[model samples]
Target: MSADDSSATARDSLDGGAATLTTRRLRYLGAALATLVALLHLLDPNHGLLELFALLYANPRVLVFDPRPAAFVVSATALLVGVSLSRNAPNRRPYYVAGIVVALTYVVGYLAWHLTGHGGFLPGREPLLHGVAPVANVVRHLTSDPWAAASMASELGLIATLVALLRRE
Candidate 1:
Protein backbone atom coordinates (compact mmCIF):
# COMPACT_ATOMS: atom_id res chain seq x y z
CA MET A 1 0.00 0.00 0.00
CA SER A 2 1.13 3.56 -0.69
CA ALA A 3 2.20 5.86 2.19
CA ASP A 4 -0.90 8.03 1.60
CA ASP A 5 -3.27 5.05 2.00
CA SER A 6 -1.60 4.10 5.29
CA SER A 7 -2.01 7.64 6.64
CA ALA A 8 -5.69 7.72 5.68
CA THR A 9 -6.25 4.38 7.43
CA ALA A 10 -4.54 5.72 10.57
CA ARG A 11 -6.72 8.84 10.55
CA ASP A 12 -9.90 6.82 10.15
CA SER A 13 -9.01 4.59 13.11
CA LEU A 14 -8.26 7.62 15.28
CA ASP A 15 -11.59 9.20 14.39
CA GLY A 16 -13.43 6.02 15.30
CA GLY A 17 -11.56 5.79 18.59
CA ALA A 18 -12.42 9.37 19.51
CA ALA A 19 -16.11 8.81 18.76
CA THR A 20 -16.20 5.72 20.96
CA LEU A 21 -14.51 7.57 23.81
CA THR A 22 -16.94 10.45 23.58
CA THR A 23 -19.93 8.10 23.64
CA ARG A 24 -18.70 6.33 26.74
CA ARG A 25 -17.94 9.59 28.52
CA LEU A 26 -21.36 11.03 27.78
CA ARG A 27 -23.16 7.88 28.96
CA TYR A 28 -21.30 7.78 32.27
CA LEU A 29 -21.89 11.50 32.83
CA GLY A 30 -25.61 11.14 32.23
CA ALA A 31 -25.82 8.31 34.74
CA ALA A 32 -23.89 10.19 37.40
CA LEU A 33 -25.92 13.36 36.97
CA ALA A 34 -29.18 11.43 37.29
CA THR A 35 -27.98 9.69 40.44
CA LEU A 36 -26.98 12.98 42.09
CA VAL A 37 -30.33 14.55 41.32
CA ALA A 38 -32.14 11.54 42.76
CA LEU A 39 -30.10 11.62 45.94
CA LEU A 40 -30.76 15.32 46.44
CA HIS A 41 -34.50 14.82 46.29
CA LEU A 42 -34.57 11.75 48.52
CA LEU A 43 -32.23 13.21 51.10
CA ASP A 44 -33.43 16.78 51.15
CA PRO A 45 -33.51 17.98 54.75
CA ASN A 46 -35.56 21.09 54.17
CA HIS A 47 -38.27 19.91 51.81
CA GLY A 48 -39.00 16.53 53.27
CA LEU A 49 -42.61 15.36 53.56
CA LEU A 50 -44.45 17.68 55.98
CA GLU A 51 -42.26 20.58 55.01
CA LEU A 52 -43.38 20.12 51.42
CA PHE A 53 -47.00 20.13 52.41
CA ALA A 54 -46.58 22.63 55.21
CA LEU A 55 -48.39 25.32 53.29
CA LEU A 56 -51.18 22.96 52.15
CA TYR A 57 -51.91 23.99 48.57
CA ALA A 58 -55.55 24.60 49.42
CA ASN A 59 -54.82 27.16 52.07
CA PRO A 60 -55.24 30.74 50.94
CA ARG A 61 -52.65 31.93 53.46
CA VAL A 62 -49.88 30.21 51.52
CA LEU A 63 -48.21 31.79 48.54
CA VAL A 64 -45.88 28.86 47.89
CA PHE A 65 -46.48 25.18 48.42
CA ASP A 66 -43.68 22.80 47.60
CA PRO A 67 -44.87 19.23 47.21
CA ARG A 68 -41.90 17.11 48.19
CA PRO A 69 -43.42 13.99 46.62
CA ALA A 70 -43.32 15.64 43.22
CA ALA A 71 -39.65 16.35 43.64
CA PHE A 72 -39.04 12.70 44.54
CA VAL A 73 -40.93 11.55 41.47
CA VAL A 74 -38.99 13.82 39.15
CA SER A 75 -35.70 12.79 40.69
CA ALA A 76 -36.52 9.13 40.42
CA THR A 77 -37.43 9.54 36.77
CA ALA A 78 -34.13 11.26 36.13
CA LEU A 79 -32.31 8.39 37.82
CA LEU A 80 -34.05 5.92 35.57
CA VAL A 81 -33.22 7.98 32.51
CA GLY A 82 -29.59 8.07 33.55
CA VAL A 83 -29.46 4.32 33.97
CA SER A 84 -30.98 3.91 30.55
CA LEU A 85 -28.45 6.20 28.91
CA SER A 86 -25.55 4.55 30.73
CA ARG A 87 -26.56 1.31 29.08
CA ASN A 88 -26.13 3.04 25.71
CA ALA A 89 -29.63 2.42 24.64
CA PRO A 90 -30.58 3.11 21.02
CA ASN A 91 -32.77 5.95 22.27
CA ARG A 92 -30.20 7.46 24.58
CA ARG A 93 -30.41 10.86 22.96
CA PRO A 94 -34.09 11.23 23.72
CA TYR A 95 -33.57 10.16 27.31
CA TYR A 96 -30.75 12.64 27.73
CA VAL A 97 -32.86 15.44 26.29
CA ALA A 98 -35.73 14.52 28.63
CA GLY A 99 -33.42 14.58 31.63
CA ILE A 100 -32.23 18.05 30.69
CA VAL A 101 -35.79 19.24 30.34
CA VAL A 102 -36.70 17.81 33.72
CA ALA A 103 -33.75 19.52 35.39
CA LEU A 104 -34.59 22.84 33.76
CA THR A 105 -38.24 22.57 34.75
CA TYR A 106 -37.40 21.86 38.36
CA VAL A 107 -34.88 24.66 38.64
CA VAL A 108 -37.06 27.24 36.90
CA GLY A 109 -40.20 26.25 38.79
CA TYR A 110 -38.51 26.47 42.17
CA LEU A 111 -36.91 29.80 41.38
CA ALA A 112 -40.13 31.24 39.97
CA TRP A 113 -41.76 31.46 43.38
CA HIS A 114 -38.89 33.48 44.74
CA LEU A 115 -39.02 35.69 41.67
CA THR A 116 -42.72 36.32 42.24
CA GLY A 117 -42.16 37.85 45.68
CA HIS A 118 -42.38 34.68 47.75
CA GLY A 119 -38.95 35.43 49.12
CA GLY A 120 -36.77 32.44 49.96
CA PHE A 121 -38.40 29.07 50.40
CA LEU A 122 -36.84 28.81 53.81
CA PRO A 123 -37.38 31.40 56.50
CA GLY A 124 -34.67 33.89 57.53
CA ARG A 125 -32.90 33.40 54.22
CA GLU A 126 -34.75 35.91 52.16
CA PRO A 127 -31.57 37.50 50.97
CA LEU A 128 -30.39 34.21 49.50
CA LEU A 129 -33.32 34.08 47.11
CA HIS A 130 -31.99 36.62 44.66
CA GLY A 131 -34.24 35.71 41.73
CA VAL A 132 -33.54 39.01 40.07
CA ALA A 133 -29.87 38.40 40.69
CA PRO A 134 -29.43 34.71 39.92
CA VAL A 135 -25.66 34.88 39.87
CA ALA A 136 -25.58 36.41 43.35
CA ASN A 137 -28.04 33.82 44.64
CA VAL A 138 -25.82 31.01 43.38
CA VAL A 139 -22.82 32.53 45.10
CA ARG A 140 -24.70 32.93 48.35
CA HIS A 141 -26.09 29.40 48.20
CA LEU A 142 -22.61 28.00 47.71
CA THR A 143 -21.36 29.95 50.72
CA SER A 144 -24.33 29.48 53.04
CA ASP A 145 -26.27 26.21 52.76
CA PRO A 146 -24.85 22.77 52.11
CA TRP A 147 -28.01 21.59 50.29
CA ALA A 148 -28.17 24.68 48.14
CA ALA A 149 -24.49 24.34 47.33
CA ALA A 150 -25.00 20.78 46.18
CA SER A 151 -27.98 21.90 44.15
CA MET A 152 -25.98 24.62 42.46
CA ALA A 153 -23.22 22.15 41.68
CA SER A 154 -25.75 19.71 40.28
CA GLU A 155 -27.22 22.41 38.08
CA LEU A 156 -23.79 23.04 36.64
CA GLY A 157 -23.36 19.34 36.03
CA LEU A 158 -26.73 19.05 34.33
CA ILE A 159 -25.95 22.01 32.13
CA ALA A 160 -22.65 20.51 31.13
CA THR A 161 -24.27 17.21 30.25
CA LEU A 162 -26.95 18.97 28.28
CA VAL A 163 -24.33 20.79 26.24
CA ALA A 164 -22.53 17.54 25.59
CA LEU A 165 -25.73 15.92 24.40
CA LEU A 166 -26.40 18.78 22.07
CA ARG A 167 -22.94 18.61 20.57
CA ARG A 168 -22.75 14.84 20.31
CA GLU A 169 -22.70 13.26 16.87
Candidate 2:
Protein backbone atom coordinates (compact mmCIF):
# COMPACT_ATOMS: atom_id res chain seq x y z
CA MET A 1 0.00 0.00 0.00
CA SER A 2 0.98 3.65 -0.47
CA ALA A 3 2.30 5.66 2.51
CA ASP A 4 -0.92 7.69 2.63
CA ASP A 5 -3.02 4.52 2.80
CA SER A 6 -0.76 3.09 5.50
CA SER A 7 -1.04 6.24 7.58
CA ALA A 8 -4.85 6.21 7.24
CA THR A 9 -5.02 2.58 8.36
CA ALA A 10 -2.82 3.30 11.36
CA ARG A 11 -5.00 6.24 12.35
CA ASP A 12 -8.14 4.18 12.03
CA SER A 13 -6.62 1.46 14.19
CA LEU A 14 -5.66 4.01 16.84
CA ASP A 15 -9.16 5.44 16.84
CA GLY A 16 -10.62 1.98 17.27
CA GLY A 17 -8.27 1.29 20.15
CA ALA A 18 -9.20 4.55 21.81
CA ALA A 19 -12.87 3.75 21.53
CA THR A 20 -12.36 0.36 23.13
CA LEU A 21 -10.33 1.88 25.92
CA THR A 22 -13.01 4.45 26.55
CA THR A 23 -15.66 1.77 26.69
CA ARG A 24 -13.72 -0.24 29.21
CA ARG A 25 -13.03 2.83 31.30
CA LEU A 26 -16.73 3.67 31.37
CA ARG A 27 -17.57 0.16 32.54
CA TYR A 28 -15.02 0.38 35.32
CA LEU A 29 -16.41 3.75 36.34
CA GLY A 30 -19.92 2.41 36.42
CA ALA A 31 -18.81 -0.36 38.74
CA ALA A 32 -17.03 2.10 40.97
CA LEU A 33 -20.16 4.25 41.19
CA ALA A 34 -22.19 1.23 42.11
CA THR A 35 -19.74 0.38 44.85
CA LEU A 36 -19.97 3.90 46.19
CA VAL A 37 -23.73 3.70 46.35
CA ALA A 38 -23.43 0.54 48.39
CA LEU A 39 -20.94 2.06 50.80
CA LEU A 40 -23.07 5.14 51.32
CA HIS A 41 -25.97 3.09 52.57
CA LEU A 42 -23.80 0.83 54.63
CA LEU A 43 -22.19 3.80 56.31
CA ASP A 44 -25.19 6.10 56.37
CA PRO A 45 -24.57 8.80 58.96
CA ASN A 46 -28.23 9.16 59.85
CA HIS A 47 -28.05 5.87 61.72
CA GLY A 48 -25.66 5.15 64.53
CA LEU A 49 -22.81 2.70 64.15
CA LEU A 50 -24.50 0.22 66.45
CA GLU A 51 -27.74 0.56 64.57
CA LEU A 52 -25.98 -0.06 61.32
CA PHE A 53 -24.25 -3.09 62.77
CA ALA A 54 -27.46 -4.46 64.20
CA LEU A 55 -29.37 -3.81 61.05
CA LEU A 56 -26.81 -5.66 58.98
CA TYR A 57 -26.00 -8.46 61.37
CA ALA A 58 -28.44 -8.94 64.22
CA ASN A 59 -31.72 -7.30 63.41
CA PRO A 60 -34.91 -8.99 62.32
CA ARG A 61 -35.78 -6.05 60.09
CA VAL A 62 -32.87 -6.83 57.86
CA LEU A 63 -35.05 -8.70 55.38
CA VAL A 64 -37.70 -5.99 55.28
CA PHE A 65 -35.44 -3.03 55.75
CA ASP A 66 -35.99 0.38 54.18
CA PRO A 67 -35.43 1.39 50.58
CA ARG A 68 -31.92 2.69 51.17
CA PRO A 69 -30.55 -0.69 52.13
CA ALA A 70 -32.38 -2.36 49.30
CA ALA A 71 -31.07 0.17 46.86
CA PHE A 72 -27.50 -0.34 48.06
CA VAL A 73 -27.70 -4.09 47.77
CA VAL A 74 -29.08 -3.88 44.26
CA SER A 75 -26.40 -1.43 43.24
CA ALA A 76 -23.69 -3.62 44.71
CA THR A 77 -25.01 -6.66 42.85
CA ALA A 78 -25.07 -4.67 39.64
CA LEU A 79 -21.46 -3.68 40.21
CA LEU A 80 -20.50 -7.30 40.57
CA VAL A 81 -22.36 -8.26 37.43
CA GLY A 82 -20.81 -5.40 35.52
CA VAL A 83 -17.35 -6.53 36.54
CA SER A 84 -18.10 -10.11 35.55
CA LEU A 85 -19.46 -9.03 32.20
CA SER A 86 -16.31 -7.00 31.57
CA ARG A 87 -14.36 -10.23 31.76
CA ASN A 88 -16.12 -11.50 28.61
CA ALA A 89 -18.24 -13.97 30.49
CA PRO A 90 -20.88 -15.80 28.46
CA ASN A 91 -24.64 -15.30 28.99
CA ARG A 92 -24.25 -11.65 29.71
CA ARG A 93 -27.78 -10.67 28.76
CA PRO A 94 -29.30 -11.61 32.09
CA TYR A 95 -26.70 -9.66 34.02
CA TYR A 96 -27.36 -6.57 31.94
CA VAL A 97 -31.07 -6.96 32.38
CA ALA A 98 -30.76 -7.37 36.12
CA GLY A 99 -28.58 -4.30 36.48
CA ILE A 100 -30.95 -2.15 34.43
CA VAL A 101 -34.00 -3.37 36.25
CA VAL A 102 -32.52 -2.93 39.71
CA ALA A 103 -31.08 0.48 39.02
CA LEU A 104 -34.30 1.73 37.44
CA THR A 105 -36.37 0.34 40.27
CA TYR A 106 -34.22 1.96 42.92
CA VAL A 107 -34.26 5.32 41.17
CA VAL A 108 -37.99 5.31 40.69
CA GLY A 109 -38.83 3.90 44.08
CA TYR A 110 -36.50 6.19 45.97
CA LEU A 111 -37.85 9.25 44.21
CA ALA A 112 -41.43 8.20 44.63
CA TRP A 113 -41.02 7.40 48.29
CA HIS A 114 -39.37 10.73 49.00
CA LEU A 115 -41.90 12.68 47.01
CA THR A 116 -44.85 10.92 48.57
CA GLY A 117 -44.18 12.00 52.14
CA HIS A 118 -42.78 8.66 53.26
CA GLY A 119 -39.16 9.43 52.68
CA GLY A 120 -37.25 9.21 55.91
CA PHE A 121 -37.66 6.91 58.84
CA LEU A 122 -37.86 9.99 61.02
CA PRO A 123 -40.99 12.10 61.28
CA GLY A 124 -42.12 14.70 58.74
CA ARG A 125 -39.55 13.97 56.09
CA GLU A 126 -41.57 15.45 53.27
CA PRO A 127 -39.66 17.15 50.49
CA LEU A 128 -40.80 20.65 51.30
CA LEU A 129 -37.31 22.02 50.87
CA HIS A 130 -37.16 20.47 47.44
CA GLY A 131 -40.55 21.87 46.53
CA VAL A 132 -39.66 25.34 47.71
CA ALA A 133 -36.11 25.49 46.34
CA PRO A 134 -34.95 22.61 44.26
CA VAL A 135 -31.58 24.12 43.62
CA ALA A 136 -31.06 24.69 47.29
CA ASN A 137 -31.76 21.09 48.09
CA VAL A 138 -29.40 19.88 45.40
CA VAL A 139 -26.67 22.25 46.45
CA ARG A 140 -27.06 21.45 50.13
CA HIS A 141 -26.91 17.73 49.60
CA LEU A 142 -24.12 17.91 47.04
CA THR A 143 -22.05 19.99 49.39
CA SER A 144 -22.96 18.83 52.89
CA ASP A 145 -24.03 15.25 52.31
CA PRO A 146 -21.68 13.49 49.95
CA TRP A 147 -23.40 10.14 50.46
CA ALA A 148 -26.63 11.52 49.09
CA ALA A 149 -24.83 13.16 46.22
CA ALA A 150 -22.95 10.00 45.38
CA SER A 151 -26.14 7.99 45.51
CA MET A 152 -27.74 10.25 42.96
CA ALA A 153 -24.61 10.25 40.82
CA SER A 154 -24.34 6.48 40.91
CA GLU A 155 -27.91 6.14 39.77
CA LEU A 156 -27.17 8.34 36.80
CA GLY A 157 -24.01 6.44 36.02
CA LEU A 158 -25.79 3.11 36.20
CA ILE A 159 -28.52 4.40 33.94
CA ALA A 160 -25.97 5.59 31.42
CA THR A 161 -24.15 2.28 31.60
CA LEU A 162 -27.39 0.44 31.03
CA VAL A 163 -28.17 2.51 27.99
CA ALA A 164 -24.68 2.07 26.61
CA LEU A 165 -24.84 -1.66 27.10
CA LEU A 166 -28.20 -1.84 25.38
CA ARG A 167 -27.18 0.21 22.37
CA ARG A 168 -24.97 -1.08 19.58
CA GLU A 169 -21.82 0.92 18.98
Candidate 3:
Protein backbone atom coordinates (compact mmCIF):
# COMPACT_ATOMS: atom_id res chain seq x y z
CA MET A 1 0.00 0.00 0.00
CA SER A 2 1.10 3.62 -0.59
CA ALA A 3 2.55 5.37 2.51
CA ASP A 4 -0.25 7.95 2.40
CA ASP A 5 -2.93 5.24 2.33
CA SER A 6 -1.30 3.35 5.23
CA SER A 7 -1.06 6.54 7.30
CA ALA A 8 -4.70 7.36 6.69
CA THR A 9 -5.78 3.86 7.71
CA ALA A 10 -3.73 4.06 10.91
CA ARG A 11 -5.31 7.40 11.81
CA ASP A 12 -8.81 6.03 11.24
CA SER A 13 -8.06 3.02 13.40
CA LEU A 14 -6.69 5.20 16.16
CA ASP A 15 -9.76 7.41 16.07
CA GLY A 16 -12.05 4.38 16.25
CA GLY A 17 -10.14 3.02 19.22
CA ALA A 18 -10.33 6.32 21.01
CA ALA A 19 -14.09 6.53 20.46
CA THR A 20 -14.58 3.06 21.81
CA LEU A 21 -12.58 3.87 24.93
CA THR A 22 -14.62 6.99 25.52
CA THR A 23 -17.88 5.11 25.27
CA ARG A 24 -16.72 2.48 27.74
CA ARG A 25 -15.59 5.18 30.15
CA LEU A 26 -18.98 6.84 29.99
CA ARG A 27 -20.77 3.58 30.68
CA TYR A 28 -18.54 2.92 33.65
CA LEU A 29 -19.25 6.38 34.98
CA GLY A 30 -22.98 5.84 34.69
CA ALA A 31 -22.79 2.55 36.55
CA ALA A 32 -20.66 4.10 39.25
CA LEU A 33 -23.13 6.92 39.75
CA ALA A 34 -26.00 4.51 40.18
CA THR A 35 -24.04 2.40 42.62
CA LEU A 36 -23.01 5.50 44.54
CA VAL A 37 -26.60 6.59 45.05
CA ALA A 38 -27.63 3.18 46.27
CA LEU A 39 -24.64 2.92 48.60
CA LEU A 40 -25.30 6.36 50.09
CA HIS A 41 -28.34 4.89 51.80
CA LEU A 42 -25.97 2.69 53.78
CA LEU A 43 -23.21 5.19 54.54
CA ASP A 44 -25.23 8.00 56.01
CA PRO A 45 -28.16 5.67 56.68
CA ASN A 46 -30.14 8.65 58.00
CA HIS A 47 -29.73 11.94 56.19
CA GLY A 48 -29.11 10.84 52.62
CA LEU A 49 -31.74 12.14 50.21
CA LEU A 50 -32.69 8.80 48.67
CA GLU A 51 -32.84 7.09 52.04
CA LEU A 52 -35.08 9.85 53.38
CA PHE A 53 -37.46 9.47 50.47
CA ALA A 54 -37.63 5.70 50.91
CA LEU A 55 -38.33 6.07 54.63
CA LEU A 56 -41.11 8.58 54.10
CA TYR A 57 -42.74 6.65 51.30
CA ALA A 58 -42.48 3.05 52.48
CA ASN A 59 -42.97 3.34 56.26
CA PRO A 60 -41.77 -0.22 56.71
CA ARG A 61 -42.02 -1.23 60.31
CA VAL A 62 -39.46 -3.35 62.09
CA LEU A 63 -40.56 -6.92 62.38
CA VAL A 64 -40.73 -8.49 65.81
CA PHE A 65 -37.45 -10.24 66.58
CA ASP A 66 -35.73 -8.49 63.71
CA PRO A 67 -32.89 -10.31 61.95
CA ARG A 68 -30.72 -7.40 60.83
CA PRO A 69 -27.42 -8.74 62.15
CA ALA A 70 -27.91 -11.94 60.26
CA ALA A 71 -29.11 -10.05 57.22
CA PHE A 72 -26.02 -7.87 57.30
CA VAL A 73 -23.81 -10.90 57.31
CA VAL A 74 -25.64 -12.42 54.40
CA SER A 75 -25.71 -9.17 52.43
CA ALA A 76 -22.01 -8.66 53.02
CA THR A 77 -21.31 -12.10 51.70
CA ALA A 78 -23.43 -11.38 48.64
CA LEU A 79 -21.58 -8.14 48.11
CA LEU A 80 -18.27 -10.00 48.08
CA VAL A 81 -19.64 -12.47 45.57
CA GLY A 82 -20.97 -9.62 43.48
CA VAL A 83 -17.58 -7.99 43.46
CA SER A 84 -16.00 -11.22 42.27
CA LEU A 85 -18.59 -11.74 39.59
CA SER A 86 -18.22 -8.18 38.42
CA ARG A 87 -14.47 -8.74 38.04
CA ASN A 88 -15.05 -11.76 35.87
CA ALA A 89 -17.75 -10.21 33.70
CA PRO A 90 -20.40 -7.52 33.56
CA ASN A 91 -22.91 -9.81 35.26
CA ARG A 92 -26.01 -7.70 35.65
CA ARG A 93 -27.86 -10.45 37.47
CA PRO A 94 -25.44 -10.67 40.39
CA TYR A 95 -25.21 -6.91 40.67
CA TYR A 96 -29.00 -6.66 40.79
CA VAL A 97 -29.22 -9.45 43.33
CA ALA A 98 -26.67 -7.73 45.54
CA GLY A 99 -28.62 -4.51 45.32
CA ILE A 100 -31.81 -6.32 46.32
CA VAL A 101 -30.09 -7.94 49.26
CA VAL A 102 -28.86 -4.58 50.44
CA ALA A 103 -32.34 -3.15 50.10
CA LEU A 104 -33.93 -6.02 52.02
CA THR A 105 -31.54 -5.62 54.90
CA TYR A 106 -32.58 -2.00 55.16
CA VAL A 107 -36.21 -3.09 55.20
CA VAL A 108 -35.57 -5.39 58.11
CA GLY A 109 -33.88 -2.56 59.97
CA TYR A 110 -36.86 -0.30 59.39
CA LEU A 111 -39.25 -2.96 60.59
CA ALA A 112 -37.25 -3.32 63.73
CA TRP A 113 -37.41 0.43 64.22
CA HIS A 114 -41.21 0.42 63.91
CA LEU A 115 -41.70 -2.43 66.37
CA THR A 116 -39.39 -0.81 68.86
CA GLY A 117 -40.77 2.72 68.33
CA HIS A 118 -37.15 3.85 68.49
CA GLY A 119 -36.26 6.37 65.83
CA GLY A 120 -32.67 6.63 67.02
CA PHE A 121 -31.99 2.98 66.31
CA LEU A 122 -32.92 3.36 62.65
CA PRO A 123 -32.05 5.82 59.87
CA GLY A 124 -35.06 7.97 59.09
CA ARG A 125 -38.49 8.82 60.56
CA GLU A 126 -42.09 8.32 59.58
CA PRO A 127 -43.46 11.64 58.48
CA LEU A 128 -46.48 13.06 60.25
CA LEU A 129 -49.69 12.64 58.33
CA HIS A 130 -52.38 15.09 59.40
CA GLY A 131 -55.53 12.98 59.04
CA VAL A 132 -54.47 12.06 55.52
CA ALA A 133 -55.58 8.40 55.82
CA PRO A 134 -54.56 5.15 57.45
CA VAL A 135 -52.97 4.06 54.23
CA ALA A 136 -50.92 7.22 54.02
CA ASN A 137 -49.81 6.75 57.59
CA VAL A 138 -48.72 3.22 56.87
CA VAL A 139 -46.88 4.34 53.78
CA ARG A 140 -45.11 7.13 55.61
CA HIS A 141 -43.71 4.75 58.21
CA LEU A 142 -41.83 2.36 55.89
CA THR A 143 -38.08 2.86 56.28
CA SER A 144 -34.69 1.06 56.45
CA ASP A 145 -31.12 1.63 57.68
CA PRO A 146 -28.59 -0.04 55.40
CA TRP A 147 -25.01 0.87 56.39
CA ALA A 148 -23.80 3.53 54.03
CA ALA A 149 -20.07 2.89 54.27
CA ALA A 150 -20.21 -0.81 53.54
CA SER A 151 -22.68 -0.31 50.74
CA MET A 152 -20.59 2.45 49.19
CA ALA A 153 -17.43 0.39 49.40
CA SER A 154 -19.09 -2.63 47.87
CA GLU A 155 -20.49 -0.56 45.05
CA LEU A 156 -17.14 1.05 44.35
CA GLY A 157 -15.51 -2.33 44.32
CA LEU A 158 -18.04 -3.55 41.83
CA ILE A 159 -17.45 -0.55 39.63
CA ALA A 160 -13.73 -1.10 39.68
CA THR A 161 -14.23 -4.71 38.81
CA LEU A 162 -16.51 -3.86 35.95
CA VAL A 163 -14.09 -1.36 34.57
CA ALA A 164 -11.28 -3.85 34.75
CA LEU A 165 -13.33 -6.53 33.10
CA LEU A 166 -14.37 -4.22 30.29
CA ARG A 167 -10.94 -2.72 29.72
CA ARG A 168 -9.41 -3.18 26.27
CA GLU A 169 -6.15 -2.30 24.57
Instruction: Please tell me which predicted candidate would have the highest TM-score against the true structure.
Output: 1
Instruction: Summarize candidate 2's per-residue lDDT along 1-169 as a digit string, tens digits.
Output: 5564465457658787775566566656666665665555556665424444567787646535443554455555555656566556544445556666766776666565544434544444444555535445545545776666676777778778856754412
Top lDDT: which candidate number?
Answer: 1
The better candidate by lDDT, 2 or 3, is 2
lDDT of 3 by residue, 1-169 (tens): 5564465457658897674566456546535644453444433434444344454466635322233433444454455455446544533444644544455555555544444453334445453344545444434554222354355444555445445433321
**What TM-score does candidate 2 reach?**
0.58
TM per model? 0.64, 0.58, 0.33
Residue 142 CA displacement from its true place in model 1, Å: 4.9
By summed lDDT, the worst window of 10 consecutive residues in model 2 runs over: 117-126
Cα error of candidate 1 at position 69, Å: 4.3
List RMSD in Å for every model shown. 7.6, 7.5, 12.5
Query: Candidate 1 on 55-115: residue-level lDDT in tens?
Result: 4464624423434455655565566656665474544556667777777765775565445
lDDT-superior candidate, 1 or 2: 1
What value of lDDT does candidate 3 attain over all alpha carbons? 0.47
